[model samples]
Target: MKRILAVLLVMALLMSCVSLAVAEEKKSLTVWIPQYQFSKAEDAISDQDFWDGVFDKFEEENNCEVKVEIVGWGVYGDTFFTSLLNEDGPDVVYVTDNYDLVKRDLLLGLDPYLTDEQKDNYILWSTAPENAAGEKVIVPMDDGVAIGYVNTDILAEAGYDELPLEWDAFIEAGKIIQEKTGKRAFLQNWGATSGTSALMLAFWPYYFQAGGKMLDENGQISINNEAGLKTVEFLKKLFDEGIFDEDIVTESESVDKFANGEVAYIVADLNKGNTTFTPAGVNWQYVFSLKGDAGFGARTATDSFAVNKKTLERGNDELAVKALVYITSGEVMDAFHSQIFYLPPYTKDASFVKDEALYALTSAHSDAIYVVEEFEAKKSFEDTLLANIQDMFQGNLTPQEVLDETMEYYNTQLKEE
Candidate 1:
């Protein structure tokens, strides 16, 4: 009887050990990314194929399983913030221009995991505001600048050889195109609420060209000054010339107008390099923003990788950080750009990009890829300014009134915050 009891006790112990081993072997992780390139199955899984392959490689190397979830870029902020509030959430997340505002409570600080040298490998601007506190919150994956897309065919038809080099020249060309073609010269995405970031992208070059600065080094609002006013007046002139599409408030309508060849020029980012002109089968060329009075200036935005703090605190941070480093590596970035057709974040030689039109724009406008660090703490103010500008576009307010109302609203928000 004693022997039988001993055998049974040993068997029970053995089974318990086996169960624990199985649980340990079943390691898994989740990653949340934007839907931009990953929305379609071909682009997400096959065309680039590297993202999935890299995840699988990480799984093999770490002996774990990775699950990727695609979220829309528009809703990523809300979804990521809400998920962070929950105990069970993704181990890693992706962020873009909105990271600075979203990092307050939602993101994990990676200072504890990364060495100084490891951190130094990344572009400082790509990680900033989030990493301003010496805590690394994001890793940059890709970088690109806003650029001008001109349908040269339309310009040639209007009796122009190339895009105008200055704002006045640009306007004159547009007017000529309108007169010759009886179609809108420029089609911009605009609406009644606030100028879309796209419009802001278009307007920024002009502001810089007009010798205006968005803010000073001390973070004071400088855009309300005379130079900034001139910039607003320039946009108003464009609107009044009847060169821009009538439905400036609706982007879809603007896009339709441009796509149908009813518009001569459009403003776009690098991602649109392939889709906007190529898909339309139009003979188009990209130009750097026409030189502004203060020299040419451009605004660049980035999307980065960030880890979840709660997950790191739970002792799973090393894997997350490793995954981030892998994704942000030059090889991965180059591969991603090759597939998605975006500018690389890392400052590397892009001689390999064989597309002449893209290469020309990137080369000439390279200086305009303004890193975020170049600007101070006025993103909120800029947002308000953009909103008020949209109100001006809608004709609900004059340019001067828009500036005054925006300043008032911004000051009030500053006090409340």
Candidate 2:
């Protein structure tokens, strides 16, 4: 009996040592991402479940733990910056723009991890990956284009069979829409609540249509010119004629209103229409950005994944990059965008497209789509521009004054930067 007890005790000690060795062998990585179009309903798969589904296989294969945190958009920027300043958290992060982070040298370049096949197969922005000097900091995941959603029923009622494609005719159509249908002609959200999306969807397209470039030959912001004035004056015309309501400056429900058949037209990102308008049974067709004196133009936005430089300090830089590559692989991005929005996958291998016809239509307008240029003072420039536009809408500033003031502020901010 004493011999048997000694043998059992020796076996138990060996097992305990084995467990400790395995624990030491495992590695961990943390990923921070903003909640992008995720459903929060009780019946919906939880964000954790979705991430686990994507990462579990990787974890099992590599003996690594991947921790994903889905953050709210409101607090994401502040939280990310704060955590980064502390030299902790987030091995990888979702990036819409990495200008500021790259400027601060807080992001890692992705060129080493990218394969030749990926470089050849992925549809990338002209300046992406190398948007900051020659550093390849971002790996493209998904992309969306801004489009005008024209309520077909409203168009017909307003004595038009289809929305016009030219700026002058489009404004004339808006006037006719109000005169005949007794409803608002167009709705655009200009409030701060709508944030940069409003600028991307409604304002930038028109400005671009008028040939307004954000910067001049010397790389300074210069919007107080013919293109800027034309765009603002056109908007003021829509306001003065009552085609669009003054309340647009504060209205956050333009899309909802248009979805419910209360407005003739609304400009929104192409990915948004199927969610609100389709469910409401609003008969609508997309209208590409209208032509102006310069030409037709609209902004397409891209979302990507980037590595945080903090991973180097944690001694898991390669592991973190491997996780990022896995997360943004063509197959993963294809499945992810399919579940959330109708955005096109940047990778060629991702085959799921929700609507082929709509995809074809949007693709036809690809020539006119330009990505927003990243600069040091992008946030402040956009904010001041939006504020000045609001003031112009409220009759506090003329269209010329709007351009003059916004241009001055943008230049001053750039100089200080």
Candidate 3:
């Protein structure tokens, strides 16, 4: 009986050893990337192939295993924040939402991992910010502008051999196309009903071109002045003349509509056009200029990757940073923007004949807004501005009244926050 009991104990110990050995063979670093990224390919298998082609090399060179988790944009922020409390969270996170995570002290500071030479790789000196603790947490991977797109087929249908360069000509062309083809002629890339996301990029450029300031040296809302009023009036004009759709809300996108030939012209940056219009094999070209009372210009936008602070304590922070540096550096970055359909900010000029005109207008941004990015306060400002603008459109308020409300709401929120 003693011998029988001893044998059973030895058997149990052997089983546990085998399980431990199997787990040891597959330890891996986890990375979370947005689902839509690298999804330009037709199907899931092809998309996976594209990712594997790039990541497999890194895995081999580093001799470390990795697990790539494709996170969806819809629930990415919610899931990431919840999962971050776990010690086994992803080593790197890509952020498209607000930089709230950084301000909240969630992400790892990348300053320690980066070198001056690597910083010089970008054309602009945007790497460093005064808020080194807060703003300098991201490694910028994608940057672009919002500009115009023209369908050659639509232009020809409108009886034009060349695209228009000024706002008046552009609107006139839109009218001709709508009258001739019985289709909507123009659409802004953004939905008008949403918050400041689209308006900031689509309209702010024009405001700046007209020498309108969005904020003052004291950080006061300055768009209520001449520039702000003119912009509001211009938007109203577009609505009144039916040149722009009044019903465009946060859910609408002009690119998808443009691809179906419902729209003759649109406002989309090179990257957005590249991914949507180019892939659909639409007869399109970028006719970027649409000058207002001021001049032609566009606003630049960016998306970036941030490291996880807990990964540093895990002793794999170096590997995580290396992965980030490689992903955003040289060949990867060039290929990313090229395939994704936007020019790198460092590209000397809009010399690429294929998309020259678009870049020519957007590449040299005239009025870049360096507004204070207090996340909660900015959200409050945009919400109030959106409501006031809606009231102005509904005849419940005047542009001046809207502007006054905007300033009051923003200042109050700024102080409260």
Best by TM-score: 2
Give the per-residue lDDT digits (tens) of candidate 1, residues 66-125. Answer: 788877666565677677678887888776544443435557677777777677777543
TM-score of each: 0.83, 0.93, 0.76
Which residue pairs in candidate 2 have backbone atoms (N, alpha carbon, C) closer than 3 angstroms, thus clashing? none
RMSD of each: 4.0, 2.2, 5.5
Per-residue alpha-carbon lDDT of model 2 for 1-417, expressed as tens digits? 999999999999999999999998898988887776555446665556677789998899889898998888785666786666676668888776566777787788766766777666667734574635576777766577787888999889977888886887888888888889888888888864534656887688898999888767976667788998999998888788777677879877788889889998887877767777887899998777788888888877766777888787788888888888788777777767766455766667778787676688767877777776676677767777788888888889999998888777666655465
Give the least accurate 10-residue stretch of model 3, judged by summed lDDT: 345-354
Of 2 and 3, the candidate ranking higher by TM-score: 2
Task: State the lDDT of candidate 3 residue by residue for 1-417, as single tens digits.
Answer: 999999999999998999878667543577777754544456434434455567788888886677778777666666887667678888877765444565467777776677777766654437322133543666655455566778888788888888775666766777788889888887764445546565655566666555675557874456678877777776666656777654643425777888877888776655656667877878887754466666765555545677777887888888988887777666665554554434544422213233555555544543442222334455556667776766665567777787787887666655453
**Order of the predicted models by lDDT, top scorer first:** 2, 1, 3
| Candidate 3 TM-score to native | 0.76
**Which scores greater on lDDT, model 2 or model 3?**
2
lDDT for each candidate structure: 0.67, 0.77, 0.64
Candidate 1 displacement at residue 41 in angstroms: 9.1
- For every model in order, what is the number of clashing pairs? 5, 0, 0
